[model samples]
Structure formats: structure tokens, C-alpha cells
Target chain A: MIETEQLTRCYGSLTAVDSLTLRAEPGQVLGLLGPNGAGKSTAMRMIAGFLAPTSGTARVCGHDVRRNPVAAKKALGYLPEGAPSYGEMTVREFLSFIARVRSVGGDKGYRRFDEVISRLQLEEVLDQPIGMLSKGLRRRVGLAQAILHNPPVLMLDEPTDGLDPNQKHSVRMLIDAMARQRTILISTHLLEEVHALCNRVAIIANGRLLADATPAELERQSRYHGAVSFSAQGSGVSREMLARIPEVASVEVDPLDGRVTVFPREGKPILEEVQTLLRTQNLEVSEIQLERGRLDEVFRHITTSAHPGPAA
Target chain B: MSAVFAIVRRELLSYFVTPVAYVFMVIFLVLAGLLTFYAGDFYDRGLADLQPFFDIHPWLYLVLVPAISMPMWSEERSSGTIELLLSLPVTIAQAMIGKFVAAWLFIGFSLMLTFPIWITVNYLGDPDNGVIFAGYLGSWLMAGCFLAIGACMSAATRSQIVAFILTAAVCFLLLLAGQPQVLDFFQDALPAKMLGALAQLSITRHAAAIARGVLDLRDVTYFVASIVAWLAAGVALVDLKRTR
Candidate 1:
């Protein structure tokens, strides 16, 4: 539902968003992962028509953001970073104002307002002034405003920034429920959020896109280098002996627990072989397990090892 | 049009939800009453007309209008809500005009609260109600002029204090342009016709003409043109800042 062609935004000498071209299809949630000052928010703002790109163009549902901003913006809902809102207005008034501005007319507007309020669980604080609410509740109010028009595209920047654990869980469930109907582009530094909520992930660094892939695919690519841990008690089967195995690259003995951590070569599954060796040596094997690959490890490997180049 | 009306209603409602609007109203009404009754010599001037009441509007608006309008755009910018506002589907022109009209109506409402003074004039003696009505019309138009300038200045800075100061400085210069002392200073430095044209651009001059019960089209056109010019600048500035 949204596409950008070589989009760039430069502020004097510093480029906020480089020639970044990306797309999110309908009913797809694209998680934008980036470090601080990585142009993720700038990219989202360009797509939302809040900031004009210095070069190239962004289109929403096939409408150019610059040439036909009104139509393009009408099809998109944006929740800016920091959850910025009019502090003087009550939550209901603010949502109503956004509904009117978004042109959700007639019974549709009221229906949309009711749907978003209940979806975001903002019915309890609907009449409270926004300035009086906590950060988590205020963020929900911001979310309510964005979805009140039921736009086709939703661009959220750190939608779960300030929420507590329970609130965050509810918000994630809400987002997952809505993902079946709308295109979502979520920008956040939280890696687990991407794994839990997004079907596809785009990693950006220094105004560039480094990698874009599904969460499982990204983890599998990084898992070519894996680690295995097992416990055994036997005579003459030392941790050094385990390290000397052809497939094993390194071994470390836990100082307090005396357990060994084994790093195996790529495409090597030595668990059964190690068990057989223990049996042949008449050793007592305590535990044998494979460490599951995590998205955090992949995120670090992608951002740190990958070269910082212009966005694709 | 619905978007514009939505913005107008929201802005107007905001004024009442906080103490800003109430404080402004109290200050404006008190000062307007005190200036007209005590300073303008309303009862002691030996005139049954409201000339004294209408005469103090230029100076009163020089301060009150800025106080009301300084936070209109500056607060939005400072609080980061400007991003949310610009992201809406409404164009910058619609938002600017909507905010300006809302502030103008607020000032108009405040001015209307001075009706007791109008009543007092009619109760004491026979005065020309047409002239009083014309004076009110002229005052309301001049208030619009001040609000337009204040709106543009508000758009220029994120600091409301700075906006208020800049608006006051510009408005004070406009008010003093046609005064005898200022004209005398410029008479020797510039050509006579150029100086005359500069003086004619002063809001004080046109406001005075209308306050004297003369509804000259040129004076009316001057106020309208001034409002349009400044509000247009406001719209352009909003666009520029949003793009940045």
C-alpha cells in the first residue's frame, strides 16, 4: 500500500534519510529496526507526508505524497514519535478533532471513533485531559487518534515506547489483530518487538537499509555459527579434549559451575556424536541442549558487521 | 470547509478549557473599561458620544491582541504538536485561515462585552448611534489587523514570549508611523510624497478616519488588505516550516 523511490532528506550537511527505497504491501507489517539517529523516523515522516523528501518521491496507495498530498494523506494514518498531542484537549476531543480532520464523515466517523477507542482500550480515560494522563495512556490516545479514520496504511513510530508490560502485551495483541486488515510500518529499536509482531523486518543504520528479510530467515542466516552446551562426568574426557574435536571450534569451562560451552562449526550437529562418544567412554552425560538463536544476536550481527552504505 | 470549521471549533474550545482565555478576557475587559472611563475621560470630556471609548482601541489592541494570539502557533511548535497538525489532510492555507478567524472572533466577543459602556453613553444623553456602530465596526476590523500580524509573528518563532515581543514591536511601529513626531522626523530625510504614503499606511490613521463616523472604502480596503497580506504570509511561513 506504500512505496518510495530513492527517497532522501538532507538537513544542510547531515543527511537524515538517504536514498531509501522500500515498500509495505497490504495486510503486511514491516518492522523498521534501527539505532538512534538512523533515519527511521525521518523515513516514516517522509512516507506520511509530514516532511517532504529532498529528492525522489513517496506514494501511498498509488498517490504521490508531494503532488497529491491530500489524497495520499487521507489514505494514511501516522503516529509520530514521542506521541505528540495537544495537551490542552481531552482525549475524546482530540480524537474527535482528528476524526473530523481525517474526513471520517457521518455514522462512519462515530463508528470509527468507537472502534478505535475500544480497540486501544481508551474508553476509561476518554474524558480526561491528555496532559493529565500518564505517558502510557497518552500513547494509547495517540494511537486512538491515528486509527480513528481507519486509513489503509498505519505508520507508527515506537508505538510501545512507554507502556508497561501488560499494556505492551495488549497493544501488541491489538496491532496483531489489526495487521490482517491494514498495512503497518513500525519503527522501533526493540528487537523482540520485530520478532513478535512483524512478519518482515527491515534493518536500517546511518540512513541506509542493511537487510530486509523475515524474522526466521534472518535468524537462520545468522545461525550458521551456532553454540551447544552439554554436561558430562567421565575420566580423561576434559574440556580441552572436547575443544580438540574436529567440529568443535572453542570450549569454555564455567568457573563456578564447571559446565563446558561448545562452539561448533557451521552445518555441524555434534549432539548425537558427542552422546555416542560419552557412551563409548562409559561417561555419565547430564545434559545436552542446543542454544536457540535469538533475534537480538542477529540484530547485533547485522548492525555491527554489515557495512554502512547508502540505502537500497 | 468542514476541516476549517473543525479547526476553528477546536481552537475556540481550547481557549475556554484552560485559564488562558479567561485570564485574557478579564484583563482585556478591565483595561478597556479603565482606559475608556478614567484615562479617556468618558464622563468628564463633556461629550455624550463614545469617541473617547473608540479612540483608545489602537493602543489597547497593541497589547491585548498579541497576548491572545502569541500562543496560537508558537505553543504548537514548541510542544511538537505542529507535526501532528501538519500531518492532517488539511492544507496550510485552511489551517492558517481557520486559526486567524477563530482568534478574530474571540477578540470580537471580548469587544462586545463592552456593551455597558455603549449603554451608558445612550442613557446619559442623545448621541448618534450610527457613529457608535461605525466605531465598533472599525474597532473590530482593526482587531483583525492586529491578530493577523500577531499570527504571522507567532508562526515565525517557537517561543511565545519572543513572538509576543516581536509582534508588539512591529505593531508599535505601525501605530507610530502617522504620528506627528514620527512624521516630523522622516519629513527632512525623505521626499514629501513618499513620507505621506508611509504615514497613510499606518493603521492608526485609517482607524481614526473610521472612528470619526466616516466609513470610507479606502480605509476599509486598507484594513482588509493588511489582514490578507499578513495572513497570507502566515500561510507561507507555515508551509516553509512544515517542509523543513
Candidate 2:
């Protein structure tokens, strides 16, 4: 439902989004993973018809954003970074204004407005101005404004940036509930958010797309996938004893928690070898598990490997 | 068209929801009243017509109109709401005209509230009500001209103070273009034809012609044309600067 062809944006000498060609199909929640100043928001602004690309074009549904901006924008709902809003307007007044501007009026519009207000739980503060609301409440109001029209496509730039953990869970639940038969492209730097919400992840850095894959596929890129980690009650387990196994490439013991981890070689599984060692040595293990993957390690590796120079 | 109407409604609602509308109206009415009666010697002149009242409108609007328009587009840019606004299905032209109409209507309403003076003129002597009506029309039209210019200046920057200063500076130049002293300064350096054209560009010239009890098509056309030109500039500026 969302597509771009060599979409690029430059500010003077700096290229913010460089030759980005990507697409998001219906029923897919694509997570745009990038560090700060990675042009994620710039790319989104071009696709949302808010910023004109320096070259190439983006399309929403079937409408070209550059050629038919109004029609293209009609199909997608966008929450800009920081979720900026008119602070002087009440939540009710703000949503009503957006509905009218989007032409979401009449009986069906009223029903949709009611549903969004209740879904965002903005009933109590409907009459209060947005400036008086806390950050979490204001973000909710921004969400309500975005989804009020019930558009088929959504492009949210960091939707859960400043919300508390509980608020973040509820927002994720809302996005999850609306994920069926709709295309949602969300940009976030938080790695756990990708595992919790997105089905697919696209990693970008310095305005270039580095990796795009499913969450499971991305996790597999980490060295810790299929590795075994356990905490023992005694000093029976040592790095040298665990590293002696052929499948085990290396072993690391956490200095803080005193947990021992056995990493595999060539993405091989080392759980059985670690279990055999525990059985033979009779190690008193309190906690043990086969590590699926570590997203942060994968994210850091993928994002950093693309740029090999000194840190600027 | 509905999108334009929706924007207009929202802009008007925003104005009334804060103290902006009340404060602007109260200050405008007070200043216009004081200038008309005290500065223009309305009572001492003892004329049946509202010549003194119509005479001070251009200078009065020079400062007041900028105050009303300084926050037009600058506030949206500074607050980052421009992204949300343009992301809607509405075209940039629609947004520009909607905001312009809303501010024009507000200034028109303020102009209308000076009705007691109109009534006083009618109550005291046999004044030409048609001429008074023409003066009101001309005053509002001139206000629209200043507002259009201010809107363009507002779109050029994100700082409201910068927008205000730029607007006042531009309006001051336009107001002085037709004055005799300013013309004399340029007379020796330029041709008579160029001087005439410069004089014709003055808002004060066209407004004065309209306030003289004649709804001349030329004077009305001047105001309408300038408003359209400035608003078009504003739309272009908005489209160009919004990306940055």
C-alpha cells in the first residue's frame, strides 16, 4: 500500500534520505530501524506528502505523492515525530478539526470519531486544552487525530517515544489491533519495540538502507542465536571448560550477574553440548536457557558494520 | 471547498478560544476611537461627514494589522503543526485562503464595531450615509491589503517578531510611496513615468480614492489585486519553506 522509487531528499550539501526505494504491503507492520539523524523522519515526511523529495517520488495506495498530493495524502494517516499539535485547542476541538479537514463528517464520521475517542481513552480530558495534558496524554491525542479518519495506510514516526512503559504497551496493543488488512510503517530506534510490534524490520544508517528482513531472520544474524546461557550456584563452570567443546566457539561470563554463556560456531546449536557438560560435571544450575537471539547486538552490528570509518 | 471551509472554521475557533480575538478587538476599537476623536479633531471640525474617522484608518492599521497577522504561519512552523496541517488532504492554496479569509473577517468585525460613531454622525447632523458606508468598505479593504502583506511576511520566517517587524517595515514603505516628501527625494533620480507608477502602488492612494465617497472600480480593483498578489506570494513561500 506504500511504495517509493529512489525517493531522495537533500538539504544543501547533506543528503538526508539517499536513493531510498522501499515498499510496505497490506497487513504488514514494517519497522524502520535507524539511529538518530538517520533520515527516517525525512523519508516519512516525503512519503506523507509533507516534504518534497529532492528527486524521485513516493506513492500512497496508487496516487503519486508529488503529482497528486491531496489524493495520496488522503489514503495515509501520519503521526509526525514528537506528535506536534496545537496546544491551545482542547482534545475534542482538535480531533473535530482534523475530522472536518479530512472530510470525515456526517453519521459514519461521528461513529468513527466516537470510536477513536473512546479507544484513546480521551473522554475525560476532551474539554481540556492539549497544553495542559501530560506528554503521554498529548501523544494519545496525536494518535487519536491520526486514526480518526480510519485511513488504510499509517506512517507513524516514533509513536511511542516518550510514553511510560504501560502506555507503550497499550499503544502497541492499539497498533496490533489495527494491523490486519492495513499497511503500517512505524519508525523507531527502540530495538524491543521491533520485537514487540513489527513483523518486518528495515535497518538504516547515515541515510542508507543496510538491512531488511523479518524479525526472526534479523535475530538469526546475531552471534548469540542458538547459544546457551546459564547461571550456576557454584564455581563448577568456567570459560575454559565450556570453550573446549568443538561446537562452542567461545564462552563469556557476565561479571555483574556471573552468568556463563556458550556461543556457537557457524550459527550451530550448542545447547546439547552445554547440557552434556552440566550432566557430566554435575553443576548446580539455578537458571538455564537456550538463547534465541539478542536484537540489540544484531542492530548494533548491522548498523555499525555499514560504516567503517572513525566515529564523527 | 469543504476543506477550505473547515480550515476557516478552525482558524476562527482558534482565535476566539484564546485571548487573541478579545484583546485585538478591544485594542483596535480603542485606538481607532482615540485617533478619530482626539487626534483627528473630530469634535472641533464639526463636519457632518466622517472625514476625520476615515482619515486615520491607514495609519491605525499599519501597526494593528501586523499584530493580528504576525502569528499566522510563523506559529504553525515554530510549533511543528505545519506538518500535520499539510499532511491533510487540503491544498496549500486552500489553507492560505482559508486563513486569510478568517483574519479578514475578524478585522472586518472590528471595523463594524465602530458603528456608534456612524450613529453619532447620523444623530448630530445630516451626513451622507452612503459616503459613510463607502468609507467603511474602503477601510476594510485597506485592512485586507495590510493583512495579505503581513501573511506573506509571516510565511517567510518562523519568528513572529521577525514577521511583525518585516510586515511593519514593508507597510511603512508602501504607505510612504505616494507622499510628497518621499516622491521629491526620488524625482531628480528617476523619470516622471516611473514616479507615477511608484505613486500608483501606494495603498494610501487607492484607499484615499475610495474613502472620498466613490466606489470607483479602479480603487476596488487595486485592493483586490494587491490582496491576490500578496496571498499568491504567501502560498509560494509556504510551499517552498515548509520542507525545510
Candidate 3:
């Protein structure tokens, strides 16, 4: 539903977004992960038709952003960074204004407004001026405005930036619910938000795409891939015997729990041997699990790499 | 267009809902009264007309109109609503024209509220209603020209104070271009033909001529053309800044 071809934007000598070619289909939540000045917001703004690209093309639901901006924007629901709004306007007034402008009104519009207000829990503050609201509430109002028209494509730049923990979880849940029908692109520096919400992640730095892959695929690229840690009950199984297994490369004991964590040799599956020891020796096994590698390490490696990394 | 109307509605709503509209109207009325009564010396002149009242309008608009229009685009830029507004399915030209029209009508509303002075003049003397009506029209058109300049200046910067000062300064230059005392200095520096053309470009000259009840086509076209040109410039500036 969203596509860009060499979507480059430059300001004089500096390029903000460089030759970025990407596509996000329906029902895919693509997390645009990058640090500060990483061109994530710049690229999203171009796709939303707010900023014109110096070169290349951005399309929304098959309409070119530059050639047919109005139509392109009609299919897009954009939440700009910082979640700015008119301070003097009340929440109801602002939402109504946006709904009218977006042509999402009459019975259908009111129903949509009611649904979003209640869903975002904006009922008590509906009549209060937006300037009086806290940062988290303002961000909620911003989210309410974006989804008011039920556009098929959503371009949210740092949607969870200023939200508290509960608000962030609710927003993630809301985005998750909408993901079945919308092509959602959220740009953020939060790696956990990507791990929890995105099916595919694209890492960028210095206006270039660094890595693009599924969360599981990205984890596989980390050194922690296929590692396992287990706990034992009632005089825990010996860590020495567990380390002697052929597939085990490194073994460390958890000082707090007396559990053992094993890093298997490269391309090795050691779960069978660890389980066999429990059955053969009659050891009381409490817990055992396979670990998907940490995304922060993987994100760091790709974004800060000296050379371009592989893309999935 | 509906999109244009939507923008106009939002702008007007903000104007009336905030304190800016009321404060501007009150100050505008007070200044109009002060200019017509004290500076223009309405009773001391003992004239059975509103010539003095009409004469001070250009100067009155010079300062007051910019205050109304200085925040037209500057506020949006400062508050970051410009990005939100531009991202919608509206053209740059449409948003610019819509906002310009709203501010013009707001000035029109405040101008219409000055009808009490017109009524008082009629009761006090046998004033020419035709000339009075023409003066009001001239005032409205001249105010529109100031608003266009203010809007363009406001779009060029994100500071409302800067917008207000720059617009007032530029309008002062435009007004001075028409003055006889100002022209005396230019006569020695430039040729007569060039001086005549410079006088033709003076906003004060056209505004003053129209205020005297002369509905000259040239004056009308000048106001309309300048408004169009300035609004076009405002749109161009907005687009240019978005790329930055």
C-alpha cells in the first residue's frame, strides 16, 4: 500500500533521505528503526506528502505523492513527529475539524469519532482545551486524529515517543488491532516496540537503508542465536556435567537463581542432549527454552556497521 | 472548493474563539475614533463631510491590519501546525487563498462595525452617502492589500513579531511612494517619466483616489492585482520552506 523508488531528499549539500526504495504491503507493520538524524522521519514526511522529495517518487495506494498529492494523501493517515496540534482548540473541536476536512462525517463520522474517543479514553477531556492536556494526552489526541478517517495506509513518526508505559502499551495494542487491514509504518528508536509490533524492520542511518528483515531473521544474525538457559529444582543439576556435552561451547551459572545458561556451538542444536540428561539421570528440570537473539545488539551491528549489511 | 471552505471555516473559528479577534476589534475601533476625532479634527474643521475621516484610513490600516495578519502563517509555522495542515489533501494555493479570504473578511467585519461613525456624521451633517460608501470600499480593498503583504511576510518567517515589523515597514514604503514631499526628493534623482511610474505604483495614491469616491478602474485593478501577486508569493514561500 506504500511504496517508494529512490526516494531521495536533499537540502543543499546534505541528503536527508537517499535512494530509499521500500515497499510495505497490506497487514504488514514495518518498523522504520533509526537513531537521531537517521532520515526516518524525513522519508515518512515525503511519503505523507508533507515534504517534496528532491528526487525519486513516493506513492500511496498506487497514487504518486507529487503528481497526485491530494489523492495520495487521501489514502494516508499521518501523525507527524512531536504530535503537534492547535492548542486553543478543544479535543472535540479538533477531532471534528479533522474529520470534516477528511470528509469522514455524517452518521459514519460521528460513529468513528465516538469509537476513537472512547477507545483512546478521551471522554473526560473532550471539552477541555488541548493546551491544558499533558504530553501523553496530547499524543493520544494526535493518534485519534490520524485514525479518524480510517485510511488504508498509516504513516506514524514516533507514535510512542512521549507516552507513559501504560499509554504506550495501549497504543501498541491499538496499532496491533489495526494492523490486519492497514499498511502501517512506524518510525522509532525503540527496538522493543519493533520486536513487539513489527513483522518487518528496516534500519537506516545517514539517509541509507542499513538492514531490512523479519524480527526472527534479525535475531538469527545476532551471536545469541540458538542459545538456551535452564533452571533445576531441589539440588540443581551439576553445571560441570552440562558443559561436557559435545554441542556446548560455553556454560555460565546464574548467580541469583543457580540456573545454567549454555551457548551452543555454531549451527548446533543442543536441546536434545540437555533434555536427555534430565531423563537419564533423573534430574528435576524446572525450565528450558530456546532464545531468539536480542534485537538491540542486532540493530546496533547493522546501523553502525562500517560496510552495508545484508538485507532480507 | 470544499477543501478551501474547510480551511476558511477552521481559521475563522480560531479567530472568533480566541481573544485575538475581540482585542483586535476593540483596538481597531478605538484607533479609528481617535484618528477621526482627534487627529483628523472632525469638529474643529466644521465640515459637512467625512473627508477627514476617510483621509486617516490609509494610515490607520498601516499599523492595525498587520497585527491581524502577522500570525496568519507565522503561528502555524511556530506551532508546527503547518506540517499538519499541508499533509492533508489540500493544495498550497488553496490553503493560502482560503486563509487570505478569512482574514480579509475578518477585517471587513471590523470595518462594518464602524458604521456608528457614518451614522453620527449623517445625523450631524448632510454628508454624501455615495462618497461614504466608496470610502468604506476603498478601506476594505486597501486592508486586503495590507493583509496580502502581511501574509507573505508571515510565510517567510516563523516569528510573528518579525512578520508584523517587516509588513509594517514594507507598507510604509508603499505608502511613502505616493507622497508629494517624498516625490520631491526623487524628482532630482530620477527622470520625470520614472517618477510618474513610481507614483503609479504607490498604494497610498490609489487608495486615496478611491476614498474620494472615484471608482477608477486602474486603482481597482492595482489592488486586485497586487493582492493576487502577494498571495502567490506567500504560497511559493510556504512551498520553499517545506523543502528546507
Which candidate number maximizes lDDT?
A: 2
DockQ of each: 0.78, 0.81, 0.74
TM-score of 2: 0.98
TM-score, one value per model: 0.94, 0.98, 0.95
Q: Please give, for residues B1-244, the per-residue lDDT of candidate 2 as tens digits.
A: 9889888888898999999999999988898889888998988988888888888898989989998899999999999999999999999899999999999999999999999989988999999999989989988999999999999999999999999999999999999998889999999999999999999999778877766767788888999999999999999999997455
By DockQ rank, best first, the candidates go: 2, 1, 3
Tens-place lDDT digits, model 2, residues A1-312 = 999898899998999988888889999999999999999999999998889999989999989999999999999999999999999999988998999889899999999999999999999999999999999999999999889989899989999999999999999999999999889999999998999999998888878788888989988878889889999976434567788999889888888888888889998878888888887888888889998888899889877884632221
- For residues A122-191, could you state the per-residue lDDT of candidate 3 as single tens digits? 9999999999999999999999999988999998999999888999999999999999999999999999
lDDT of 1: 0.86
In model 2, what is the error at residue A115, expressed in angstroms? Answer: 0.5
Error of 3 at A157 (Å): 1.2
Name the better of 1 and 3 by lDDT. 3
Model 1 per-residue lDDT tens digits across residues B55-153: 898999998899888988999999989889888898888988889989989888988999998888889999999888888888999999999999999
Docking class of 3: medium
Clashing pairs in 1: none
lDDT measured at residue A275 in model 3 versus the true structure, 0 to 100: 81
TM-score of chain B of 2: 0.97
lDDT of each: 0.86, 0.90, 0.89
